[model samples]
Target: MEHNHDNIKLTSAEVSYLWNTYLGDSLSICVFKYFLEHVEDKEIKTITTHALDLSQQHIETIQSIFLNEGIQIPQGFTEQDVNLKSKRLFTDVFYLKYIKNMTKGGLATYGRLLQNIYRHDIRSFFSKCLTSTIELDTEVVRLLLEKGIAACPPTIPYPQKIEFVHKQSFFLEGLGRRDALTGAEVANLHSNIETNQLGTSLAIAFSQVAQSNKVRKFILRGNDIASKHIKVFSSYLEMNSLPVPMSFDQEVTESTESPFSDKLMLFHFGLMIYAGIGNYGVAISESRKSDLVVDYTRLTAEILKLSEDFANIIVANEWLEQPPLSANRKDLTKG
Candidate 1:
């Protein structure tokens, strides 16, 4: 006989993943709904609708799990956070690419979460998440290729034979590294450049529409940071004569009307900052060349500073939500 899921309490991993998933999907729902309002291409709209449905369904499932466990349902983003009537701030191409980029993040998160999760129910849910995100990612890639907007990575010559590194210089660089970038390094650099492009576009769009001066300034600073990071990463690819991805800045419209609340905008930036940090962390660990590691480390510090500023702004606005925590033994014993 199968043990009842309710009879077993959720472990820290389970609770944290569920809570984090709720937050991410809630944010996605707002962003996707806003995208759906402005998306005009038929095929793009269909995929956007599918993405939105997945987020909504995920939110409902999480809510049900939390309520059944007697845990408080997080007041994730809602209608109040979005304005469907607001003017379009991005082009149809931007909408499609945005969904594509976001699904990549979703796949990574769900896949990693599955590694630590052991509960049957939670595992099944995240397993479903992994599968659905894979579907979304595959669909978006096909459309991107079909519509000729993929900005696909450069092709390298076929390997003639297996090889091994024999020199210690492969890992050492006193002034500047002279070794050609490995395929892994090239992949990480290319992916980072693409991510920063998306970041730059988002910063520009958010800066234009944010109501508060502080929020606008923060996002504009983020734009500069993302742009600088893109250039730094792209130079490595260019030095190797590899093609760089195209910019999405032109896809953002000139509209200054805010389609999302300041709270939601700040919260979204926080998510982006953390996600960027995680990406850089992965790049750093996977990297073998000394300079690439140093550069990634330096830029990661910059992003860390940006995350600090985000914390200050979000806290000042009182928009940050507290996640579930261990019981306060000290509080229980007090007075």
Candidate 2:
């Protein structure tokens, strides 16, 4: 099972991972290129360079795999998708935290990928991806701590002794006010808050530079959505006397000049929306209380709608790329 049998062709799952990874990395390249152009802090620049290098390498490797398999490459973002001459959109501090969030997400993505990826070479590729991303994550975290900007999760007092939940009301319904949050629940809440905080910053930045009216309005609405979600998530932590994660809206600049094409910006928003939806799904399972589950499910549905709107905008511009699809059985039968 460890060695890849060359005779074995790739399953749909394997192809899906590679195809999706290719698109994500390609988008990262465009964003990082714009970051590097205006990034001032030496420490932030160092990690940004490393991140850009990693994305470039990933694109090359994925290209090699697709060519070898006779699969057509996805038309992901390219140089034309970015405009280097545009003014800076984000601050140096934003760049540092952005990498931290990115690698954190990358670890989750590449780790989950290993479960479905069976080919030895493909598995090995993602394994290496996990390792490299961990290294980047460490570097970003260390820098954040050194700068004293680390938003460490709230610390709860240790229980004197292990106790079992004996009450049925532990799964609170309307408000989780009855019982204190579990460790897993707190982690999910803080993580989601942080993600929304970052997303709000992105929404503000994107809305400032987006050329199209539709794209601008979508991202502006996204800012309101993220801010609203942040407040909801924060209230839970507040009720528990845990400090809520801080927002990064100030980290964005006032520049209105577009650094990325409208297509790229919209695509990035879609990616963020999808990730938010995925996080909500995970939070639903991690949460023990019914109210928390209901909240996540409701929020996920709202974000899913936002994702659909982004898809529509992308499609309207003819900028959406098709993923690998199975054969049309109806067409085959018609012939």
Candidate 3:
């Protein structure tokens, strides 16, 4: 490969965006393709098809940019990473939920990418991706609503008067308890609970279908962790006399056949763990209750440890894909 770009070279941020987008979209294609094969609902199938199309288009666009920049195209996930012939591992409802979850993630990822990218072309491309993801998310939400499968956040009574916090007791911790929950706090709690519920269901499904014994055990452990986290979040809402989101554990099937490779399953789980940490960090920052903040801080640490263990497993199995990195100055000097 040669440096062919005349003057417009890719900055580190641009490189990162294209590289990660390519890798993620490649994996999405594999997952969506597998889902399309097993989905029975026509509406769900249509959504899956659209998702697949968008992922494939992203791959093509990313490949062109890499080629033009004289950068090596990443060997992302392929058809070989998925088993389209495998038996259905999840129910039709699960497919819809999964799409909704992934689309939400996609929107966040693209928004962050837009902030980092300075190139007009790259920004335009990501803007388009973000727009498409928004549309897809809307469609998934509509379908989930129509089918009566969406677990909406609990409604709260509208505040009648503009009130200000006048006491330090609002940030009470330990023995002291806060009787009221702010709308922002409630929203974060509900969102975290919903995310954990989905994570628990996914872990269960992966545990059942993972081929390697170690991988299966790891996934089972993750299922327990997610379940425990859900309980913690739900308890917060329950104490406030608020309803909690329902779990999707029943949406998984008893299929022992693997729909995806152990590598993909582990990688996907690792991504969820990272996302969980980020979500918890946000919750901790926005929460006024010291008890809630402490809980999120402890939970984030626990998940960080789990993520490290996951990385070790991937490295041991030679399944971890190296991300973009700067050159080692020490190594360069020795060479």
The candidate scoring highest on TM-score is 1
- Give, for candidate 3, the lowest lDDT window spanning 10 residues: 1-10
Number of backbone collisions per candidate, in order?
0, 0, 0
lDDT of 3 at 137: 97
Point out the worst 10-residue segment of candidate 2 by lDDT: 171-180
What's the true lDDT of residue 160 in model 3? 95
| Rank order (by lDDT, best first) | 1, 2, 3
lDDT of 3 by residue, 189-274 (tens): 99888888888898988988888988888888888888888888888899989999888889998998999999989888988999
* Model 1: per-residue Cα lDDT over 1-335, one tens digit each: 57588679999889988998898899899999999887889999999999999999999999999999998888889999999999999999999888888997998898888999988888889999999999999999999999999977776677899998777678886644565887888888988898899989988899889999999999999889999999999998998999999999999999999999999888888888898999999999888889989999999999999999999998888888898788999999999
Best-performing candidate as measured by lDDT: 1
Q: What lDDT score is found at residue 241 in candidate 2?
A: 92
RMSD of 2: 1.7
Better of 1 and 2 by TM-score: 1
User: Per-residue error at 268 for model 3, in Å?
Assistant: 0.7
lDDT of candidate 2 over 1-335, digit per residue (tens): 46745588888999999999999999999999999999999999999999999999999999998898888999898999999888988999999989889998998899887999888888888998999999999999999999999887889988899899776678864533564888889999999999998889998998888888999999998888888888888888998899987777899999999999988888888888988988898899888888778878888888988888888888888888888889989999994
Model 1 — TM-score against the truth? 0.97
Reference-based TM-score of each model:
0.97, 0.96, 0.96
Ranking by TM-score: 1, 2, 3
Q: After superposition, how far is residue 143 of candidate 3 from its true place, in Å?
A: 1.2
Model 3: lDDT equals 0.88
